[model samples]
Target: MSDARAPASVEVEGLTFHYPGAEDPALREVAFRVRPGERLGLLGPNGAGKSTMMRIACGYLPVPRRRGTKVRVAGLDVATQSLAVREQVGYLPEQVPLYQELRVREHLEFRAAVKRVRRRARRAEVERVAGLAGLEDMLETPIGRLSRGYRQRVGIADALLGSPPLVVLDEPTVGLDPNQVQGIRTMLKNLGGAQTLIFSSHILAEVEALCDRIIILSRGAVVADETVSAALASDTLSIEWGRPSSGGGGEGDAIRGAAVQACLEQAWSRFDAAGPLEVELSVVGDRVQATVVSGPVALDELAAAIGAESLAAGLPLVRLEPGRRRLEERFAVVTGFREAPERAKGGRS
Candidate 1:
């Protein structure tokens, strides 16, 4: 990577920080880089130092006593050019502090001025960002009167004031309706190419959707830094298949269910014969549900084989489709967090 001219937009080496009266350090030798145009998601359970790292990156917290450890933002030393580093970053905190008395337009205009936007183009810039954040309609409305969703938009608008290349957003979509979440996601995706974004979220779905890469933290250290595809590569491909008959007879339903079960058993037997294998199959409704835990197989292949074998026995192929991967299951397996049966886990997703 030496000849690569440091693809990193932000770099940190040997970063460690401790809080007053804390038994352990909040960050310990945390080292990672945010490459130019990379949308990196920081993910962790509660109290995993994700927020601490964000604070350090935003210059809200100071480095430890050891000096010259090396932290840089936009090629400026975070230790020395602290003010310059702050000037180049746009930070959206989790609480989203804003003056409730100010109108949406007034709040954005005030932030732009604080960021030293030029007098001639400040209004135009404010309007452009307001539109970008979908705040155009509420520009004249008081912030306190806006909904939680609109308040979030105003916070995002404030962060974009100086046209900073690096944007750090914390829990940008915590309490929004589906439509509001969609709007925020669309805006972030639109900004992906022009800005280097580092967002932290406890919601796995959000990270999977918005981030090109993810850095999962556990116990105040980096546990995983990989693309979503890489993180979920070992997931099982669930298959469901059923046979249809001329009429909806009870016998036909039973036969279809039995055939699907037989197909799954046969597949598992085949896999076992090929190698040491572990799999699971069961009946769900009129179809058979199967999960092959060991090796990866394509959904089409599993469905096609089952369909062909069923049709050879004079049964009509009814339905065949792939099931979505359960992110919680994959997380448990990868992170070694053994969970009870999903239904038994308080029935909360």
Candidate 2:
């Protein structure tokens, strides 16, 4: 059991690692802390070191000698107390490794024994996990004969054997059918708050659903770390307006542009008296688009203010949407797949 006074569930400080012959380090100065019972999502594109970090957290990989590189699980230093750390964490890797010939019950029993459950309590432990993983009906089935989803369940059952305080899953629902995915997601939701969970998946929706906090990695470096709500909220407002027809009695491009600029300036002066806002206006053919970039603020209020100002300025309000970047869009920008014009212009505050 861990000391009662420990302040964190999992801690990694200045963690850096390199494969034996690789050209670059697999992880670089990674650092974060998982509060007890917090469901954290570890996100990254392929080759972003999610697997490497997971292994290190579960004490499967050795801690490098780099200064300040440390990993502690349940108040025990993973480097010095590897066995205890392993006992404190239940791990389900991306690949579900199981004995092909063993029955589901037999495999779980074997895992319980390996995890050092008392001989007399092993049966109860196996049955408990089997029920939790929805494997009670399949206990008699051979591992080799089960579908991919069932095999994954067997792996989860094994991990849950000793009721570890921390559960780390790597792509737990990678290739399951929709039903199977839903089942697994439901199981994970039930596990929330009962144990601290850290899982990695390319499915953003799944991550968003199961995790309270998110850590995004790009090329082995921690890029963005924030709560899901904050990540999804935008710090910019993008407003678009349609230019009046220029044929006979409508306003021309110059007039439309000036109207938009004046409206945006007035809105900024009213709402952003602190003067941290960057407003950009452009006339594109028959439309005018204005982007207002500022520090984190109430987006709805900003939109309302912009709408009222546009109305006062006689500008057509075609679209008044949150200009804040989406999590997916930001992920792409950070991972080097694409560039964001707002980012380049220091628009992200």
Candidate 3:
């Protein structure tokens, strides 16, 4: 990093925000802190307050301070010292804000000047960021002439100017082709441990692949905050009991129900059933298969329990597999995608 200081930390306490004349606040008593050098991903469906939280963190939105409400970025109050906060925080919104007329080098030089990069070192700073974003070859290309991928790279390079302590990217890979997305993803992966990076994305795999920690927002509330490991070990699993003991009709039916009941018993023993576990069982000619959906069931522990129980019952285990990551389910559950009748939108999304 060009700045000769530790990466900046972000702190928000009891923050609530409302757009002009909005009936409900965009955010509600939301609170969290990001440590220096942490890569945090903010996740939510559309209008779930993810973007609002990002704006507040980057000092683009103002917070009305109640007794416990405030937002601090890089040790500066976002409301009181927005300019200073902006100096230390580099932000790229959902739309890549660019002047298409300018050449890449010219645009970056202007950005460096705006960020107060030293006059003598400005050229070197621009070159440094350009290299980091793999734009050294396109320095003289006019931004308007560049492909969408190159344009996104230019935006990234611009954000890296002066090596700001915190870098925020919103949907940075949106609308890119596969190769372009991979390029950007690789560049972002190389940026960790040097700066405080926070971004918002609807892509579960992207967030899972990039972030060390994740915070999920739903309906203007912070619903889940967990490390990547914990978040991905969701409660869904696929379990296969040994092939039905040479049968096809009523025998297979009885065996399927019995095996799934055993699975439920094992799941319930691990933790209290948050309502009955959702189970889908099938008895094929060869094996009895079940897909179990519950809440926060650890894969290893549950698998071990089932294996032991199945062994004692003279039933061999065919396979035990983890279903989708917990983050996806939480995303669906809180965003109301799991329900037919979704909640009405009342907040300023």
Candidate 4:
């Protein structure tokens, strides 16, 4: 993934996978790289391939047989050097697998043994992870007797075994209560880049809170790969507009509704290519204002183009300011859950 002395923390290239007898591939030409010590969040709806991708990266699922696909962990190929990759990854799946009869401490010790920790050092290793997961008090309690939150902590502790270089967690906070979720999030945050972390969750807030970078998957394709700031910004621009002159000295109110929308469409049409913008129009007192948002775009160039368009049409441009889209809506546009504003007659998208 890079020329650095250490290989990428995790890497995927031209990855595509299909379940047996499935019509559509679960993942389609997906490619991304996770940097060493970075926290990456995988975000998508159900069946969006988030879990499948994680499984493939963890070596639990096989990479496609096709030649173009490659999956690697810590510079080791997952398809060929899975044993070595396993040694470098600690994985927690959507469902926690635990032996109900075993106590928390015993479960961790067994996992450490399975991970091949040295015989004499397994107990000390188990204690270390338990403390990180806040499971010291529950270490002696049988897993079946512990609360759901405690059980989740046990699963996390198990994954932390051996201090693997890459830690992959799939929906680790799915069923936990608010307090439980907060506790687990804080614990993982405290890891502080000790190991690279890749996690998935349906909760956008949780993902934004825990990850410095995020990769959004949609219908098996990589839709967005951005740092938290860039992802949320969505390159929004808010403009305050005035009515264009109607071939006379006085400004006309005719450009209030559809005319305003047409002005925008025509302005954007001037460019060779422009990202689709979600336009929202509102009237403050007697003034007409619009909030426009799009994915990454050339703000300075666009602002100039838009200004030129307004001048050409004799539409007085009152103001041109930049703003951010609502956090959740930034995702909606890319995920196809919502469409842009359809009208300017006091209508909002």
User: Which rank order by TM-score, best down to worst?
Assistant: 3, 2, 1, 4
The better-scoring model by lDDT among 1 and 3 is 3
The sequence of per-residue lDDT tens digits that candidate 1 reaches over residues 35-121 is: 887889987777778888887787777756575477888888877777877877888898999999999989888888788887777
Q: What's the alpha carbon RMSD for model 2? A: 5.7
Record all residue pairs in model 4 with backbone atoms less than 3 Å apart, i.e. clashing.
none
Per-model CA lDDT versus the true structure: 0.71, 0.81, 0.79, 0.79
Which 10-residue window in model 4 sums to the lowest lDDT? 1-10
lDDT of 3 by residue, 237-325 (tens): 77787654654567667866576577557645766654445666667656777766544566567667767767766566788877654
- Among all windows of 10 consecutive residues in model 2, the one with the lowest summed lDDT is 340-349
The C-alpha stretches of model 1 lying farther than 4 A from their native spots are 1-8, 65-68, 235-275, 282-289, 295-324, 330-349
Q: Pick the candidate with the highest TM-score.
A: 3
Question: Model 1: how far is 239 from its true place, Å?
Answer: 5.0
| Index of the highest-lDDT prediction | 2
Pairwise TM-score winner, candidates 1 and 3: 3
Q: Total backbone clashes of model 3?
A: 0
Error of 1 at 294 (Å): 3.2
Q: Which stretches of candidate 4 lie over 4 Å from their true place?
A: 1-8, 237-322, 341-349
lDDT of 4 by residue, 1-349 (tens): 1111232388899999999999998999999999888889998878889999999998899887788888988889999987878878888998999999999888899899898888888898899889888788998999999887788788899998888888888888866789878888997776647888899888888877888899988899998888877876646578887654442222434346445667677766665665555577765555668766544557766677668877776667899876654546756767788875342323333
lDDT (Cα) of model 2: 0.81
Model 2 agreement with the true structure over 225-260: per-residue lDDT tens digits:
888877776677777898555421245677777677
